[model samples]
Every structure is written in structure tokens, then in C-alpha cells.
Target: MLSTVLLRQLTDQVQELHTTAESQLQPLPLPVLNFKPTPGSWSALECLEHLNRYSRFYNAELTTALHAQPQTATPHEVGFSWLGRKSYDTVRPDNGKKHRTITHMNPAGSQLGTEALHEFLQHQKCLLEMLAAAQGTNLNRKAVRIEFFKLLKLRVGEALQFVVAHEQRHLQQALRAAHQATTAPILVV
Candidate 1:
């Protein structure tokens, strides 16, 4: 089961993510939203699309985990395996370092309209709901399958941390893209 402290921390992070997405991303003009620093880099929309891809997998896993068993009032402390901890650290936002995206998570350069932001917002809301539902759920013991690797699994709490951190990283990338646009005024404030 998830501890009250961990759940509160996770909820706060999710709330911050939602607020950032709404304020920084949703109000941008289309051209600015779509601006990419270079041919190879992702635009704000693409960054969000990339996040949507991961969220699709995670939200499903979280929903399943929530319904998989009954929750308890007794809280369990969250811990991660060495590999999981390392993976979580690596995904955290650090503008100085850029990691190559796996093919599956990479967004195509296709033009995404405002609907992309709406979808991303929806995903964020789902994540918040999942976090709340996970309050008394066994986050450490219950494994959620990773989409990238069939055999790899992260405990529920670890997965939540990774997903939230990954969102922050990409959101930073998106905000950077917005700020760096030459064709449009900065939309991030």
C-alpha cells in the first residue's frame, strides 16, 4: 500500500505538472507551439505527443493496478530496485543533457493542432486521478509492465515517479522550444 506521505508528495507533483501544462502550453499561438529549434529537435507539440505516448501506457497500467486489488489504510514505504532508481534519475529534467528518444516514444514531425494540448491535458488529469486512486494501493509490491521492454517491470510507485519526472523533462523541453522560437514571440511565462 502507498504511504500517506508518498501519496501527498506525488499528488503535489502531479498538480504542479497540470498547472504548468495549462499555463505554459495551452495559451501558445499555433506557430509558436509548433516551433522546433532544429530539424531533428521536437516542437512543443511533439514533446507533448511524446509524453502522450508514454502516458497512454502508464495510465492503462495504473488503472489496472488500482482495480487489481483492494486498498488498505495501512501504508507501505516505497523503495526502488537499483535499476529502477537509476532509470528514474536518468529521466529527471536536466537541460544540460539530452537523451535520445526510443523510436516508440519519438513523435513524428507531423503538424499537430491544438487538439494535441487537449489530449495532453486529458492525460495529466488521468494521472492525477490515478495518483489519488493509488493512495492505499500496494505501489512497491505491485509491478507495472513497461511498454519499452516486455520483460521489464517497475513497481507502481516507481513507475509514477518515472512518469512524472519524464513529463517534467519533456515539458521543460517544450517550454524551451516555445522560448527559442524565432518566428513567434515567447509564449512561456
Candidate 2:
């Protein structure tokens, strides 16, 4: 992956994320669960929940990688596995289908609630900060072992790709959830 391309993609993702969160996430009415169609399915809120989780994880990883080798010309890299990949697909579960985080990350099992959005946004902003300060070595260097995967070696460029791609993947899912929330009908009293 190239830095210029990576920056472009990240920039796009950031802008899209801002738009999605500001425009799509907010118009949602309160009690997101109300819009949910089934017990197992995720409401639009849940999609945001998952995105928050995913973003936090990458934010930490990106910060660590950049800090660990601030002077290196090679930017550190991170990679997700096939299992992670499967869980990360852009699937917008209908209200009938449950919209839970896939198995590999479920035990992601952290706090999956409304507050997650705020936390995610903060961390994502931090990631953007680091990205801005990022320079020659940081952008180009590769990591010997991507800690998350535990056994993969990747370039810094690929790591950035993963971060943006992961967000985009979840963003799509969030959009689906939002659509469901808005279009679903309710029985008014």
C-alpha cells in the first residue's frame, strides 16, 4: 500500500464517518431497541455499537504502532485473519436476522452500549492525529508481527488499509441498520 493512497482513503473514510455519524446516527429516535425487529437482530444502534468497538481497537493499535517506532522509516502494519474477515463482511442483517458482532470478535465482549460511540469518535480522532503527524519511515515501515493476528507480518501501508477498510465495512453495516430503523413501521397508540 502507498502512503498517498492510504491518506486519500483514510481522508475519505473520515469524511464519510463524520457524515454518517452526524447525519445518519443522530436522526434515529430514542430507544434504538424499539426499532429492532427481532430479539436476535441488531438495531441501527447496535451497528454503531459494533463500529465503535472496531474503531477503538484499531485506534489503540495504530497509536501503539506509531509510537513504538516513531523514528523508523517503516510504518508498522496490522492484519486481520480470515475468521476476522468473515465476521467483518458488509452484511446488513434484516430485522429478522440478528445483527450481532460475528463470532471471532464477539468476545470483543467489551461494553457494547451507547457510550461506545463517543469513545470511538475520540479514539478515531486520535488515529487521525497520528496519521497527520506520520512521516516517511512511519508511513512506509512494516511490522514484523501484527499483534492482533499474532502471526502475520505486514507493512504500515497495509495496516492503514485495514483500519480504513474496517471502518468502511462497519459503516456500511451501520447504514443498513439506520435504514432499518427509519423504514420500520410502528403501531402508534
Candidate 3:
């Protein structure tokens, strides 16, 4: 795909994510946001916090890498590398496969609040900025170091795709948690 087209799609996804959070997730009460569907499952806030943890790392890396590249005359068509294709495919929402989260990135038992949602929104904003900066850069260049494996790198386009897809996965998880929490019977002692 053309780099401009890919970036535009990513930009739209980010905006939709922001709107979804504000409209659907943001209005929930604290107890609802913190409610877990099952004993070991994460709550809505935990999901957002998990995304926040990743954004903290990825946003910085992407910003630095984009700044280092000189702008091109036109957007280049972007293609995924072998590793990039594998990496993003694993995280895409439709994959329906569970992967274990890294310890530090896991927010399973963290004391998260509405602030978690706020942080995620802020991260989305940063992601939008990064996407804008990515235009006219070489999307096929392996510029971003993967968070899980420091030595391995992804092309800039693939990195953006991975990040947005990851967010989509967790956002759906969070929405499910919120729905279950709101609809489930509240047992009183």
C-alpha cells in the first residue's frame, strides 16, 4: 500500500479509538471500570493501563526514529518484512489467540483508575502526531526496535500497524469487561 494511504488509515483508527474511549469507556463509573469479568481476567482500567505501559515505550521510540529520517519527496509504498508481518499478525484482534504479557507491561493487579483512560487518550494523541511525522519517510526502513526483543527491528509502517492493532485488541477486551461488569448481577452481602 502507499505510505500515505496506510498512514491515513492509521490516523482514522486512532481517531476512532479516541472517540470510542470518550463515548463508551469514559462514562463508566469507577466500580464498573475496575470490575473484572472473572477471577483472573483484567478489568477495563487494567486493559487501558496495559496499553498505556506499551505506549510509554513505543511512542518515544517512534518519535526519535522518525526525527532521525530525512523527509522524502513523496510517500513510498510500504511493505511488511517477515518479522513485521509475523509480529503484527500475532496481535491483530481477529487472531483470537492469547499471548502472555511481559511482566512489566502487565497491569493485571495494578491499582488503576480513570487516569488510566486519560493516559491512553494522551498516548493516542502522541500516536497521531507520530503518524503525521511518518509521511514522506521511508516506511520500509527498519527503524524501530521491537519492545519485546531489543535487537530485532520493524519497519516504521509495520510498527505503526502493530501498535494500532494491539490497541484494537485490548480495547475490545476492555469493552467486554465493561459490558460484563455492567450487566452481571451484583450480589450483596
Candidate 4:
């Protein structure tokens, strides 16, 4: 994909995600945000917290990587490395298959509050800024080191795509939890 095209697409996705959070998720009450479909399932707040954890890591890494590159025109093409493709494919929101969360990334059972939602919104803003900063840099250049496997590095474009995909995956989970909370029948003792 052309570097500009890729960045533009990712930027749009981030903006839409932000809008969804504001429109559909932010106004939810605390009880609904904390509702879980099942005991083992994450609540809406927990899902956002999980995304917050990841954003803390990735936003910083992206900043460092973008700063290291000299300013230049956007590259003609943003090619995905094999590892990059696999990483992004695994997290695409439509994948539907469940993947185990890494231990540290799991936010299950945490006493998350409304601030989790606020933090996620802030993170999305940071991501939008990073994407804008990335436009003049070469997307194919290896920039960000993978969070889990630090030895492996992803191209700037790859890292951006993976982050956005991962966010989308969790955001959908959060939305579902919120919907269930709002629609589920109340129990009376």
C-alpha cells in the first residue's frame, strides 16, 4: 500500500474508534461498565483497561521510533514483513477466534473505574498524533521493537497496523459487554 494511503486509512480507523467510544461506551454507567456476561468474562471497563495497558507500551515505542527517523517524504509503498502480516492478521477484529491474553496484559478481575474509559480515549488521541507524525517517515523501515519479543522489530507501518487491529479487537469485546449489561434482564431477590 502507498505509505500515505496506509497512514490515512489507519488514521480514519482510529478516529472512528474514538468516536465509537465517545458515543457508545463513555456514557455508560459504572454498573454497566463493570458487567460481565459470565464470571470468567471481562467487563467493559476491564476490556478498556487492557487496551490502555497496551497503549502505554506502544505509544511510547512509536514515539521513540518516529523521532529516530529523519524527516522525509512519505515512502511510495508500505510493505508488510512476514512477521508483521501474521501479527496483524491474528488480531483483526473480524478474526473471531479467541486468543489467550498474555499474563501481564490481562485486566480481568481488576477494580477498573470510569477512568479506564477516559484513558482509552486519551490513548486514541496519542495514537492519532503518532500516525500523523509517521506520515513523513519511511513506513517500511524497521522502527518499533515488538513488546513481547523485544528481539524482533516491526516496520513502522506494521506496528501501527498491529496496534490499531489489537485495539479494534478489544474495543468490540467491550462494546458487546456494554450491550449485554444494558439489555440483560434484571434479577430480583
Every candidate's lDDT: 0.83, 0.57, 0.92, 0.92
Cα lDDT tens digits, model 2, 67-109, are 7774645433434445334433423222234454556454232
| Segments in model 2 whose C-alpha atoms lie over 4 Å from true places | 37-39, 70-104, 107-113, 138-140, 144-148, 185-189
Across 1-189, the per-residue lDDT of candidate 4 in tens digits comes to: 998889899999999999999999988889999999999889999999999999999999999999998978646877899999999999999999898999999999889889999999999999999888877888888989998899999998899999999999989999999999888778867
Cα miss at 154, model 4 (Å)? Answer: 0.8
For residues 1-189, could you state the per-residue lDDT of candidate 1 as single tens digits? Answer: 337787888789878888998998788899988988888999999999999988888889878877887787477778887767877888888636778888877886777988888998899889888877877788776578878785888877888888898998988889989888844554778
Collision count for each candidate, in order: 0, 8, 0, 0
RMSD of each: 3.7, 5.6, 1.9, 1.8
lDDT of 4: 0.92
Give candidate 4 misplaced runs (Cα > 4 Å): 186-189
Q: What's model 3's TM-score? A: 0.96
- Model 1 residue 38 CA deviation in Å: 1.7
lDDT of 1 at 11: 84
Model 3 steric clash pairs: none
Winner by lDDT between candidate 4 and candidate 2: 4
